[model samples]
Target: MDAEHIRAIAQQTGCTHIHPGYGFLSESPQLASLFPEGGAIVFIGPSTGTLRVASDKMQSRALAVHNGVPVAPGAHVSSAEDVHKFVEGLGSAPFPIIIKALDGGGGRGIRLVYAEDHIDHAFRRCVGESASRRVFAEKAFVGPGWRHVEVQIVGDGLGNVSHLWERECSVQRRFQKVVEMAPSTLPRDTVGHVIEAALKMARHLQYKSLGTFEFLIDDHAKHWIFLEINPRIQVEHTVTEELLNIDLVKAQLQLSLPKASLEVVLPAWTMSPQPSPPPGYAIQLRLVAEDPHKDFRLSTGTIGPADVFWPSGRGVRVDTWLSTGPYYRGGLQWAVGVDFDSLLAKIVVHAGTFQEASARALRALRETRIAGDVKTNVEILSGVIAHQDWSSGRIYTQWLEEKVDQLVQLGNTQLTRQSRGSLSDTAAPRRLSGGTESATATALLQPGASFQLSLSPSLPQAASGQQTQKHTLVISSIGRNAFPNELSGTITTSLSAMPLSFSLSQLSSIMASAHTEFANPADPSHVASPIAGKIVELHPALETVAGDANKGSYVRKGEPLVVISVMKMESVVNAPASGRVVRVGRGIEVGNIVAEGALLCVLDVTDMDKGLARL
Candidate 1:
């Protein structure tokens, strides 16, 4: 948590309090303990003791059991042998078991092992992703009917705690929450039991500040089990705030004050034994910068000023730090890379009814327009919101991943309709202030053309008669034609005005150069990295034949060759065919960052049919 650096900064700025603002060191015991009681700076979070137990999955499970809470059968494991033994003990309980990092949260260090053959790989991956290199095996509650629900609790570190209702976080991908809503649809009695259970644990620990107690519910069995407690504020906290009309962040800070109590810091109504139901339902959709079509790979690039248009109006809120302008000029500089989170924004909507909320969310999503080199999960969010299953409340944690293809199709259709409507609305060609001439007049737009446009807009004359403020839009290279009605090339720009118009033919001839020249489908000798990330693991098969073209190691098609970690997500690069490794890419090693399309290996395939079949 960089205690020395933080202390120095606080001393230099004369600050007395530090709010971790969730993630990173928000739940770190070391961070909280760094600033002792009555120290120069106070950490706005739970006590170090609380963080120690809550941050470790094994310890938290023990605490839950000690407090008479139900937890799934699990055991801390450090090796694949331990996982195998644990699975063997399960007997016929279930084939798929979940492996979780002992100190992981925010759905980062988790893997689902579906078969005995995958146990080792899944275990190793979990270890690699974990900060402590510790993992555990547990009985997984697989389902089409199971739901993930959590209770929002606030405490004053004095054994006084209050529940702020529950949230449904069932819509997820890769175990990470994608959509969250306040006021779960579970029966009132069931929700009451969860709230009571959460409060019981909070009171037992005297948990301070705001935290979320997560639980997994099996709808078919009418059963539930304690998952784990998030010792700090959550990413989906906005939905709860919108539903309850309360400021959780403010409450968290106030609770951090000495002598603060729940009764003193919270509303009188919240102190009731049975607080009133929230006024409305609220839903939050996470907008991540990823390409859903490519297995949700993390996308990195600049978003032009005209590339992103956020939605607005009543009952809607968009929270984000993304802006499309130069960093020094007070614009948001996108620094999302292998080291940063892919979350770009969160769109929250509140309405009187669930259906109304869903409709409003869809409207807001449709109104949002994000273009340029950067890809986002807006379509995925739209698909989940518009699905019949989502509208009917028939969703679970795996619902999004299970129906991702169908959802993507639906979202694309909706997007196409919206695009058509927008095109019709702006059928007339607009003129720039420079002249009536079309921006595409001088250029013979074609694939691979090195054409660029720099617009120097004439700003109003200053009192000192300074030169007009100018903005530039650089178009580097055009590759292939795709969108006939829109310019398909990548534009590096700072202009926030309407996009310049181009003829259909001209626009059709434009494409980003980066999208050109993919590996030929007919070639099976080469393998490339599908995304930009750091290589975290390499298969032993490659090592056996490294730098020895004459001595190749045989590998089956679809076998994992390497694993890449990007933005905290791991993706496996598999053998492209049933082949022998001639050689791996020079300088390819674990911990090395690789760009998309970078060569990873060269395979001499012996069976083409096997590769195609695997695909």
Candidate 2:
């Protein structure tokens, strides 16, 4: 992550030229400037002086002030007192404040303080969260329809700059861009101002090569404020390239050449031979293997076969870092772990109109199926492009957070139905002959139906990602007659190639057995563990705050019975209903390891049903 480590690698690999790309050392002035001392390697980016000012949010804010660029009114706050001082300086800039990492990226180190009381905690949290150990406070840009617009700039080493228009990066989650579109639709004068501001900063810093100037467009106030300067090629660079028929990375390389000039750098893109600026619109969506409903946590575990389809022809392009599908690990099963960024690919579409491009991109995503139970954000992507706000170009940075629930629901239904249909495709049995229509699933599972299923041996490969152990295989073959209604295949997650026979009459039972998860909550007879965790707090069924254990006292539903800590998250085991605890779990203490479905304590909830229903 530091310059020395990267330098060591460059030396070890004998690379004469190094591209820091976007994260880590991309904005490190120390890395960029110090690398020139090596004399053998060239860093394809801005000068150390430019990056020094651009990478530091505080310094960048100062630069904006000098250039008369509008910036969100705020200050560099190192302590709680400084936060108050900056807020007081705003006068009428509202109460809530936002604390940000001075050098953080990807929205990792940011906290919004909603009230005066939370400033201390939020400031402390932000300080610890930021890798640079520096935090800045800014006037929270509140109100509706706040958008993100970035101007793409290419500067020669001589303070000369050219603009490639702007990009709308309004659709975001966690303050990070999720979808980016070029040729942003904004007021013409306002767009021109943004471009002018970007070029001014580039000239001010003598910025060279590729860089992006980010801004926060407050639609309510009809104003745009300076945010930061990304002194490297960005993830959404493809959008601008698609609209202009240019290669930005190649341009970055050309800038580092001897006696490099704009015309000499990329004649086709920036010279006389350059064609007219391409027309139409282009939209790009970053597809990641994450579930939106679950707070976009890592979906690292079992990875099944990936049936990725990259659309050909026209303006459709999918750029991915992973070439092949996930493979077996530890000589057992297929899986993908959280070793790298969850970004699986970027889907870019260029068409005659925005609607057409949006439609085309959606089609490509739905078809680019990553098979198995691998959860992805495709359905979320689908919802975004099709949403009314997005279609009207009225999106904001928090649009994804606002539409998370609706998007997740749509995605769940789509994915669940897809998985359910996969079962139908995989569980076909006896074929009917001399008939026009095919047999229904019910007919196949009826008596006298014969079918065959397939299975694969569990084989492991050398672990490459973060996880080493074998993850449970999500998909397993099940022929029509191979499994009966009584027996299910869900029990064979780790097993491989085991053949079994069952009756067709057991279809209903088989489906239930294969799909049933955890323990049934409908039956309160068994108070099993809902998740694998440790019993960090075992309380009496009914206890007085004065330290009296009332064993026979009635426990109300939703009352905390046990507290379990799993993976740093705490989950409370609640009383299912108003019932007396028959017995406290034996040997269960403040710290006892409990597996999922492990018995916690028995509850006499005979009357809980009626009481809970009434409640």
Candidate 3:
């Protein structure tokens, strides 16, 4: 909730407490400590001091260092020149240097600078992501197999701090966690170190309610470095709850409420004054509405009727905001928007052994179906859990990046051919008679013109490599899930007088297939927009593209030429031909509305050297 909204609602409803759940005002120290004139509502998390120190990445790192916790070697640089000078002293290190905003969390406002050429762009991008203009850098824990381990610590506001084991959350993409598991396979001593460090931090801060102390375990799994403190309940809190049988939210409320003792709530506390030892194994997979094969781009749409099913038996749970609804038209609909986190739901499973829990999770995922046109990461989760590396516990942060191709293939297997048998079989396209003028909607007919056109098999095969098989597009950036596999009338053709009505039978027979690859690398003939959206980014003069290294030079295939965004889903338009960009759209600027199939630029196939000779 916004700060104004929260205060207004509290005043209006006479509410005395604000539990922000996880995001928005949850971590805002200002909001947590907000004291309007005569307004006194308890913020159910931490004191202003704890929230303030833990909010800044640099400040939290300092706290960890002050508390004798091992931290990764890094520096806080706020400017691009500072970054250049910082990297210069590193002396040819192969590991990527990480740049992060001082006031960023949840993996946003972060960048991994792999090479010198990318530093300026990454630095600028990171700085712009945060409002504070304070960015920092660190040598990334370059991995053979690094792990993300964070301890769950809860405090009772009176310096009586306790930790409930650790969670392994290494599987990530774009520096954000996608899958999380509990009770890491780290040696007991390592786990002890993580828990001890967490308790020390919590005791020092006198933190109240639920919070997390994140860390980075080195590739060999020997060294551990304190990362940062998330002073709120996390998205993966379910993993810890399922394994430890403790309700963290309840704990938070009890601790935050007036005069609630930790000992009274923890009935099974042992003689050591700590909660009973943690038990069992658990894993959680975040079900996000994005195409992992297409770089995890957001798929915002009103999900159509889906035959939903949760895993059977015990120790399995499906937590989602989707309300109960029928699996038919005119029923409960999930209108997925781009305003919040892409995580639509989470599948949490628990069992006595890690292998048993993993097996159950696989079964659950296989049984689950999200039907309709929304692209989901369910299959990707399925692939990761069932992979051999995950079973052997030899996984790391970059493991998914390395095995993305195979994992995608594993996911693509779930897309089997489904019968699209409609109202009638073999029905022709509905005809619209216009005084004996046989016009086809699909033909190359201009305004007020009519002619017959057909897909001729005898035409010369399209320029070396081309997509010959016509496809019925199944989900789109704009249309949502209303008409699955129906054409949206986006075609680029230049001929005269031909139009025909399209048939549903033909479209259904065309079948639904996902071309998951990022851009068809096989050179394209024209530069066109694939979807109706705004042109978010256009290229500068291509010096390396042309042979002469001149401004606005030619480019080879697969180079990023243009970028278009529709409803927050961004698609990069690559050069389909090895040629110089001859013509750019007159008003092609950032935020300019563009129609699908609208030509953005024209490419001249003539190579620069040959063109120079002709000149």
- The 0-to-1 C-alpha lDDT of every candidate, in the order given, reads 0.77, 0.66, 0.67
TM-scores of the candidates are 0.82, 0.68, 0.76
Error of 2 at 573 (Å): 15
Candidate 2: 10-residue stretch with minimal lDDT: 502-511
- Residue-level lDDT for 194 in candidate 2: 82
Q: Report how far off residue 604 is in candidate 3 (Å).
A: 5.5
Candidate 1: C-alpha lDDT:
0.77
Off by over 4 Å in 2: 267-278, 302-307, 325-335, 409-615
- Write candidate 3's Cα lDDT for 1-615 as tens digits: 478777788879988878888874677888876743234777888887888898888899999999999887778896888888888877777458899888777676788888888888778667756657798998888566688889988777789877777899988877778889998876667677788899999999988888999988874748888989999999899998898788888888888667776676554442154443466799998888777755676554444333344455688888976536464445445555444567777989999998999988877776555543346888788889878888998888888877888877775564332134321222212232221111122221122211112222222343233222322233334433322232354446533233332222111111111221112223354576554455666666332333232334556666667766544334567777667776564445676655433456667776566544433
- CA error at residue 596 for candidate 3, angstroms: 9.2
TM-score: which is higher, 1 or 2? 1
Taking the tens digit of each residue's C-alpha lDDT, what string does model 1 give over 1-615? 686788789889999999987886887888888888789899999999999999988999998899889999999898999999999999785577999998777677799888899999888888877888899999998778789999999999889889899999999988889999999877778778888899999999998999999999887777999999899999999999998888999899899888998887878887888876777899999999889988888776544343456788899999987653354353333445667788888999999999999989998998876554467898899999889998887899898888999999998877666644543223223333433222211333443432123333344333234323322122454554432223444445544453342211111111223232223223568787777777888877677666565666767877899999876667888876677677777556787776555567878776445545544
Return the candidate ranking by lDDT, descending: 1, 3, 2
Q: What's the CA error at residue 422 for candidate 3, in Å?
A: 24
Using lDDT as the measure, which candidate wins?
1
Error of 2 at 452 (Å): 28
Backbone clash pairs for candidate 1 read: 448-478
**Per-residue lDDT of candidate 2, residues 1-615 (tens digit):** 778888899899998898888876788988887577338888889988888898899999999999999987787888988887777777774577788889877665677777777777567656655667798999877546678899988888787777777898888886768889988866766677787899898899887899999998877677889989989999999998887788899989999876778776654454432233347889999988676655665444333223343545678888975444464342232334433466778989999888888877766665555543335788888778767777787778777887898876665454444333322343332222211112222222333322212232323332222232212122244456432212344544433243322111111111112232323334565476554455656655423321333434346766667766533334567776666556544334566555434456666777566445544
